[model samples]
Target: MKDLFDYCEFGDLKLNSRIVRTGLWESEREKTGNLTPEIYNRYENIAASGVGLIITELYSLYPRDVFSKYSNTTNYARFVREARDLTDLVHVYDVPIFAQLGMVQYSKKTEQNIAIDDVSIEDIRKIQTDMIMAAQKFDYGGFDGIQIGLGNYYFLSRFINPNFNSRKDRYGGSTLNRLKIVLEIIKVIKETTNLHINCRLNAFDGTTNGMTLTETIEVAKILEKYGADSLQITRPRSPQFFTRENKEKNPLIEASEQIIKNVNIPVILGGGATTQNQINEILNTTDIDYISMQRPFVADPSFLVDWQLEGNGETKCKTCNNCYWKKTSTCFINRSAKWDVKSEIPKKS
Candidate 1:
């Protein structure tokens, strides 16, 4: 029998399987972005559930604003310890982990005072240094790789987009001009340490005023040209960018198609792709080397593990995007909401 358990490699690291638990923003981290007992407990259970790679939430490297997405925040030491704890916990179960690294260039002057709109070239270099230091620490600890965020409101993406990155400096003019910082950051990480690099690209803005597929593809090509090991090109997501209707379609599939066609390196996709049939069709038709599941994994961390066993089982998700918590929290259709279930707890519980 063929190994339905597919295997793939990125740069120097070999992932045990191609199924990835997309770096999900569980919002369970400490207000300061530190690892919480809840977080370690959550992922420890997830690791045991059998997902090969657990790419953690989008983690801010800014020691101060590590918990920016949350209104309340924690201090620097607490954040680092929390990060270490999650990775430590994952290692015990022997699952490879990657930290999604990003910087905030959103807003003119947010509380942290480190917005991309205000970051100078020198400031960009210093931030790159901070990223390197952080990655080195993760490497020393036991992380498998570092995933780079570059699209939409991300600092690197801000610099990449002409609309957001309106500046006269070398870091923000033409395509090559804006890419100086990103290229520098990638070079620093590879030259300084041996950690695997995976570029998470915003391959399409899906809007009239933002980055087009052309711009994103051009950028992905550049990242590849510079020795980036792999690319995970997803569509323009986030309530901050697209509409509900656009979010409904599987933008990950389209972006993955564009990325696979442009780059020779391994590519991955993660978006509205939720079913076994959907994933299988994508793999058969496109060049995507991997399928990443975020919300589906959140809804049921063991979905892939179960798929491996049952080979096309029912998806627990209702395909509703209510999990996106801009204000309050709710789901499209959860156990408690159902009339049949008297009370709500995890089905597995």
Candidate 2:
């Protein structure tokens, strides 16, 4: 029987459990883009909480991008130094952490939100260079890996999607051509850094000519062949699209199962699970060994500790998605309460 708490290997990193804590907004950080005490405290709680792996909130590549305000930017001067401290804290508990790097839009000095088809060869090179540089910083800061955002509505996601990328250049037309940009990025990162490269990808975009499960599986195989250490399969609009009402038939489960069969790298079923039983069921019933949760962690960073102790625990997250809409790290429903790490419970502030 596969258990959620079983220690296992994800790529070269060993984890305490099958639960992967994936993050989004970092609204708790300082306005100056420095990691605050609150940020460190939250991470400490999560690192100690029994999560198998930790993928940090999005590290926006460009400061002026659309999601930059809601994410942690790599442009901060103290990023590497402060990130080193944060990684050290997580390492104390032997939890491997990955820095989630992504940008919603690509912008140069004058051009803002450049379309995928409009991006020049020069722009592609710049984007790749920026991503490589970010990976280098992450390695220097002691991250176990880096989660490249090829999922969701990020620029790279659109660039690789047929519906969005209409360029006649080498970056468009066929799946391989569209994927060449990401493949090139992955190759350089693999060669340059020791950090594991985990790509977050959409199982299907649900668009007319966009990425379907068939194409995504093909993409997964190519990534595995070229060198992605692991993959987290998500939808275009993930946690928001996955609510209690639609819990019975999560499309990601089937999509992930298919993708896993085609690739040798670790595959994580990202989002839509809320309880220990749910996670364990997915683990035993499917080939997916790892499960990634985001909003539940936002609700309570230490929820996994309770799940392990109780053995049948479910998350307190209402899935209200205030965190998603408001773009904050702290849960709206539990905003008034503070996490009491000592008690492993939420207390009224």
Candidate 3:
């Protein structure tokens, strides 16, 4: 069984532990979408806290593109000269960083939600090129890898999910057809860049007609075949929030175990995994290579640090889901203003 503190290797990434800081949205950017000092502080704390890897929040590849449909407040073209500073700062702690590159930048509730059936072949081609270009920029900015957002009803997930995708073209109909674009993205990135490529993929979405674990297991196999370095397994949020009954046992864990068995690449199993005992049980029992958490880190950036020193199984985060509602990711329990949330996004008068 893999121990939590043992060194881990995934492609080119080396980490001190099996713990990964999963990407959490922090709307703490300059209007120009540059990383603010406050964002830097949060990262520094996270890095010093001893998490194995840091996956930055999903960043829009093409902030201004009509097809991309990013939120006005959160969308900013990434990897500007200033953004390079973030990569540099995180590397200072010898922590590998992966930027989550999301093709269609939609929040759960807002922006233009494009139906998958409406996407055209030409648009798909254009997006493929754009994503590659974005990956190149991230490599240039000194990021360790790019985690493609292929989950959570994002643009790519919409394409992958048959319930949402309804086209009769080559990019639709069959499972492999839906996976072609992602396969292409991984192949081109491997050819063009030395940066590691991982994917944050939905193992399942808990909807009547949505994706299931069986299909996602196949998706993981194909992604590994296409040169993806790792897979971060997650589930799309249900229409309602998870209550005690559902949150205690994440259904994704069993699916992630199934995927890990099938794929050679490292698998990051995360979502609703809150305590040290739970993570320990996961690593000790399963073939899963790593564990990741988002809310625990937000509620307490030092959660790992505390666990390391004390060996306690508990986390400070209550998983109230309040952090998502705030302008920036802040723990309602702590009530500390740790980020600089830009109060007003300038309107075009």
Candidate 4:
């Protein structure tokens, strides 16, 4: 019988392991969104290390709306081809990559912003078309799928908070309506490409009046019904992870349990995924199809290989979270150097 970690179909991608290298960005790209060899090598290395699926950091769907300081890849002509090359490299390692896509909104708190009100339906159409085109290109480049990203919402998470999207139109009002845009985008991409589609939705806002698990689960069920290959869920930080502490209680984990009970498609839970026991518990205890590991991979891309092949207890990583602060995506305690590779895939004799 095939096990949970065994080769399985996730959306369009056939994954060999249940471990997914989730998105963590540190502006690793050049000024343009094109990927440098170093960045390609960084991801390819993780693929070689046994990450079943790789979802790149949130990449913009539109060209000019780039905001926030963290460097990222863009779909502009300058780097689009080179960005495709990165996907090709991952394919070489027998690992599938998903080009995580998103569009950012300027913070009204700042000097000025892209008023959601002013965004011409024509502009939205062009933007949606671009996303569809990008997903097609990712398929041409050998990627398995694309994960839709919610642009910096803590920057605007308050708006999606159900408390703030105080509007009369379709984009706002109800949680289902605010999320219709994402579902519509997925529909467009699916119509454009035959590749797998993975949709990521913010699961919790970490506040009472904010989007609670109830509303998110309702939305997730709809994504599953709409042919989403896989669904990745995470808690959107309203302020920052530094300010929010749930150590005494793991509400995120509880929410994951609730979601898994409702949906049949593979569900990925992101945020503070540290330690073997926690991951095992999610898999062993719930119907969660897989795990989305971030900081751990940054700490050591080989963390997957070591944990599985060596049977080494407790990831050598302390989860100190320094790599997170640096925003470099490279861990302080366990850079790729800390890994001592011993196993080799054998040649057919």
Task: Sort every candidate by lDDT, greatest first.
Answer: 2, 3, 4, 1
Better of 1 and 3 by TM-score: 3
Q: What tens digits encode model 4's per-residue C-alpha lDDT throughout 92-205?
A: 777888887765654223334555554455655665676777787777766678877652363234434565555567767776676665677778777777678877667776
Instruction: Determine which window of 10 residues in candidate 2 has minimal summed lDDT.
Output: 340-349
lDDT values, one for every candidate: 0.64, 0.90, 0.73, 0.65
Weakest lDDT window of 10 consecutive positions for candidate 3: 340-349
> How many backbone clashes are present in model 1?
3
Per-candidate TM vs. native? Answer: 0.79, 0.96, 0.87, 0.83
Error of 1 at 138 (Å): 2.1
| lDDT string, candidate 3, 94-120, tens digits | 788888777553322243555777766
Off by over 4 Å in 1: 1-4, 30-34, 63-75, 78-85, 92-94, 106-118, 207-209, 238-251, 326-349
lDDT per residue as tens, model 2, 1-349: 9998888998789998888999999998889999999999999999888888999999999888898889998787888999899999999988999999998998888888888988999999999999999999999999999999999999999999999999998999999999999999999998999999999999999899899899999999998999999999998898678777774678899999999899989999998888888888989998889999999988888887777666799998999888999999998887776774645632212
- The numbered model that scores best in lDDT is 2
User: What are the per-residue Cα lDDT tens digits for candidate 1 across 206-295?
Assistant: 555567888777888888888677777665454332333454666667767877788888777755555676667777776666777666
